[model samples]
Target chain A: MTLNWKSGGVLLGVVFFLAVALVKPIGVSTQFVIFDGILWNAINPDVVTTTADGFTSPNAYLAKSGGKYAEAVANPINYSFIFVLAMMVGAALSVLARGGLSREERAMPELWRSTIGGSSLKRYAVAFVGGFIVLYGARLAGGCTSGHMMSGMMQTALSGYIFSAGAFAAAVPVAMFMYKEV
Target chain B: MTSIILAIVIGAAFGATLDRVGATNPSLIGRMLNLTNLHLMKTILLAIGVGSILMFGGQMIGLVDVGHMSVKAAYIGVFIGGLLLGGGWAMSGYCPGTGVCAAASGRKDALFFIAGGLFGAAAYMGTYPAWKASGMLDDIAGGKVTLGTVPGASYEGLTAISGDLLGLAIGAVFVLVAFVLPDTASRSGGQVQPAE
Candidate 1:
């Protein structure tokens, strides 16, 4: 494949260098936190604020970010949210440039077809639910794979290693069950 | 507005690079997890390995900030969350970051996944009080601690080393593992070949 480990790794490494040089760190989950804060602020601004000095969030996990969510919600045009949206633009350009958009986007693996069958709705539903669960877990954990595993692990943070190990432990078995049909 | 523009520039490059690497491909992700195509894992390790070098190495040269380096709280919630995210990844072939890129790549399933993730976030926000009161959110290992500063975590009762040194050692291991992993991965799971 053109996008093999060597090629892909080099591309990501460059991205990382740019991210650190141009930004503080690279991560993805805080985008969701900002999403939540925006929604809540729209509904009731009272929920996220505590005092003049700081603001509060419903999830203590976000609060642990040292007021990141509060600031993202209040200002809404900061580094994390911008980084998140930029990722989308980056991906879209890549697809269009590579003619990936022209290719038929199909469910991965025969497992998706043989088991789930030809139901677009089921595919969507599964993706949606999986998305929801993962987002929830990511918020609770204070980061996602990119936020913790990628950025934090690079710093040799303990949580990064633990999270990586835990994720691999659960993911490998679940994948075997899904794919092997065992 | 400056930050927004910067974000767009940076984000565009990030998204494009991710696509170039096939990080947006669900089949590749599934195969990696299946242990058939070890390329994806190897790629991830390489990225992390190299990133650690740049980050810590940069600090020594005054290019990066050791102070600005944010270490997450070493708590149990993170582990459980990682497990769920991992399972979600294996099941759906999309994690939070990759899912966004997938959506942008125009995969309908990925778009729906993003919507689902949003709905999930809203649900979590709605139930925040009860969840927080459960005390799981309380820091267990006590406030932000890195691998080099954890209180009880130990390897043979040896104390932690400098974060930079640890970063280097781990980076080396990742680099070695990425190079050594076999290129072939079991494709027993599907009919779809690697994207051309």
Candidate 2:
């Protein structure tokens, strides 16, 4: 049961509008940082410390923004962190409610099958490598598609436009090169 | 307390919307980027355009608070990172948000994506000091500036044009482009077929 792209677009727009209109813009990559801090702090007790000022970390990245990241590490139950977890739950619910994957979804995508037919293992490896590159870039940029491009552009932030240009600039060429058959 | 509840509701809605739109499907994402199919691209453009209109329009009439606007700082690193992200996106078919959502949809492969993301984030953390020393993080191009002036917003404008109106204009253009775009850029790739 796939949604029509038009309706899906409008619905996605409305959701984004409400989020920005109400509390704050939606972001995801920062949560990755918080996740790292949580893991790092678990391994090393001194990585994060609570002080009168709230929270601080020995690591500069976690300690930057006036210990904001550090505070999130110390208190993982914040709005942004919970939001990421909730996103997962929501996706799961959507799939479950639909009964099961449609036949189209269950099989290898046509493009993948046609161009790079291989074991699921190969696809999984590619996905992992891709995720790593995207996340690493997101960290360097301080946001991902959600934070920098979508929300940022909606807010008319200059950096958002620049990021979009840079993203499409690289994405289009890479996709073209990789999927020559299609 | 209220914010936390709102987060769940919003985040869920966000994720469900992504799933319904096929953003969680790596294959579909690949098709979109490859220009084989433009369905997802149109959806993305339309969504951004409509969302922008509502937001900028709401702020114009005081329905949305100007102070709530969050503009990310501009820096050379952001642009470089964006280029890297684009390359990765073309290769992987998933971004951070979509990767998480994809995993939740019971795609075992997405789990590896998540692990990779975690490792990537940690790598960034470990190399943070070196990045900082490189001065790429330093703000540039009027740091946190907007395209046009937004009254009461903390960020400065690169131009004196009204930010709200500028946003609306750009949003309208996006909507127009979305309508004009075809389903597929290539004739051979008119419609994606279901796997046999």
Candidate 3:
């Protein structure tokens, strides 16, 4: 459980794919739609009809598809969100197993220190900013990295490639700039 | 029922692996942003390789049905969203999934990222009417098309043959590069301080 890059990368890929193949494809943003669909139906059942199969009716489709106000309150737990939840559990187990679970000082990059104004503050800021960008992009793009790149590419979808390329293109330069000051 | 159970198990495993690999740490991810650590890149590549082989191979052997998968094409949105996401990643050091993982690991900063994301999502919902009226979601044609549809091949053909072959090649390249590359601070040499 040394958590080297190679092993970590391989594990991530394998676990992600297994999740897709065995259950559902890995996506981070799909939760929004599913939640939206459920909520819309719950509030105004008339506005959101239910199919004979127990799925959301066509009336609610727009909210689910477009992620309107009603959709956000309906379903609190989405599949992708659940997947994210699992990822946290997995990460915690990994840390505990490695005996790295204590809340202690960990090494941080210098640029981060300057940006957040404090070591801990920087972590929150980075997460907030990153999440905002990612969620916004997920909304705009209609999917997140796991949905578009990982699962999409697995099925050979053309858009997946485009999204993946874009992600890497952005990730590399930014990563280089931030880490150089470390 | 099976899928849900499987999802929970797999999700836990995925999260654990991310944590073990140091992916839950902002600094580790930041290293990738700075190019000091190619670990993230290598991890992504390897994941792609492994996933391709498993999924495509399962399809080829008739063990899995690839047809049930959903692939939607929101071309304009993906493009613009990607740009914004990349910029944000540069400024912040975490992604949605990693940010959540970081927070779960008791990183206080990750909480900010989570709060920011919730606000952003809520904000998007509140402003949906204007965005929809602005026609940002219109005129989209691409839906579920893959490499197989472009040429003389079918989806199965592309995934089973071309996709599989390419995945293997890419995986091999990653293995080669990882072996040949020198150890940087992010790779093997950096001394990780005991968790606080």
Candidate 4:
């Protein structure tokens, strides 16, 4: 059974607290970069190389911070990378424990049908495009909601607050435009 | 090894919490942003608020290390990127974290989202130098600074106020908003059905 919004909200807060207090703040977007580095390194071995100091890459971005990103690429089984993979595994297990995806989950969502009024194919395409834009933006910003917004704000970081403001400044307008009242 | 195990445990818990909160559904996210439903938004704000209180309080009592805190450098790109991310988030129901979780929950559409994210990340990597040259990545507004001074942390504070107290105040506000907010701001409503 799903949690009511109140309980779910508190639970999510606790999970994030544990993550920050114990090891580090929760983040997922950087793993996306590491994933790309992994794939690129696999295709071209020269992309990441062991240097006298540490791992280095031909790409400037990968080579920054003393090739830390390159090191993750060469050895993909690190904390952040594995954490991302585990998130998927965790989601899968949660779904399985509840039996499986429900009919409403597996099918097109009701809000989508009533508001957007499109086939599932259109939804998928829009979802894909949306994901692409967000990831690109996340990389550009060097963080996503979990990192800059959630974790940043929790830490009282000024950047986090700025990013959150910027995010909502755009998100609210876009959502209103897209899902106008019938 | 311990860190690896912690990663798995924490990641799993994080993912499960996301699913339980209905974040694995795109439509729910859409509803939240559109103000048709605020269940997910309330959950997110509450979580952030509580987490902030625990973390800052833990830091004050010496239970949590300030050294572990990471402060990303502020830049023009971050704000611009945030704007773009917000727009995309409104359009797509998934962000990086939720997209992967949604795929795991067996949404075929989420798979496409993940693929798109991968491609988008790679594109950023390819164009990194250009963006860097454009100065969007340059530090702005006391780069890597905090709202208030946090003891034992390296980042400078914009003010002399205690960071811990400031965090607590903001966290309380978030919690208060979460509690006070209606389930739906839409005039058409009763309790809007959750995406479930």
* Top-TM-score structure, candidate number: 4
- Could you list the CA RMSD of all candidates, in the order they appear? 4.2, 2.2, 5.2, 2.0
Alpha-carbon deviation at B75 in model 2, angstroms: 0.9
The collision pairs in model 1 are A86-B11, A90-B15, A90-B16, A91-B15, A110-B190, B36-B185, B36-B186, B37-B185
* Candidate 4 C-alpha lDDT tens digits along B1-196: 9999999999999998888888888777887888888888888889989998998889999998888888888999989889888988888878899999989898887888888899889889899999999998999988898899888889998899988898889899999999999877884655454454
Global fold similarity of model 1 (TM-score) = 0.87
Residue-level lDDT tens digits of model 4 in A1-182? 66777799889999989998889999999898899888888888899989888899889989988899999988888888899899899888988888988666665556676788758889888888988899999989889999998888888888898888888898988887787655
Show the lowest summed lDDT stretch of 10 residues, model 2 chain A. A102-111
The residue ranges of model 3 lying beyond 4 angstroms of the native Cα positions read A32-62, A66-81, A101-111, A114-123, A176-179, B129-141, B149-196
Poorly placed runs, candidate 1 (over 4 Å): A44-51, A54-67, A106-111, A114-116, B149-160, B187-196
**Tens digit per residue, CA lDDT, model 1, A1-182:** 34778878867876775676566568887687678778877888665777577766655544645776776787777877878888998888778777665434744334565544667788888888888888877877778888788877776666787778777888888777776522
For residues B35-110, write the lDDT of model 3, one tens digit per residue: 6655666666667666766765666566756554566574655666666666666666666666666677766666
Model 3 chain B, poorest ten-residue lDDT window? B149-158
| Model 2 interface root-mean-square deviation | 1.4
lDDT of model 1 at position B155: 18
lDDT by residue (B31-107, candidate 1, tens digit) is: 67777667788888899888877766776677765555666776777888888888888878888888999888878
Best by DockQ: 4
Winner of 2 and 3 under TM-score:
2
What overall lDDT, based on C-alpha atoms, would model 3 receive against the true structure?
0.61
Clashing pairs in 4: none
Residues A108-148, candidate 2: write the lDDT tens digits: 44456667875677877887898788889999988889998
Query: Which wins on DockQ, candidate 1 or candidate 2?
Result: 2
The digit string of per-residue lDDT tens for model 3 on A32-97 reads 444444554567676444344333334422445453423333444545556666777876666666
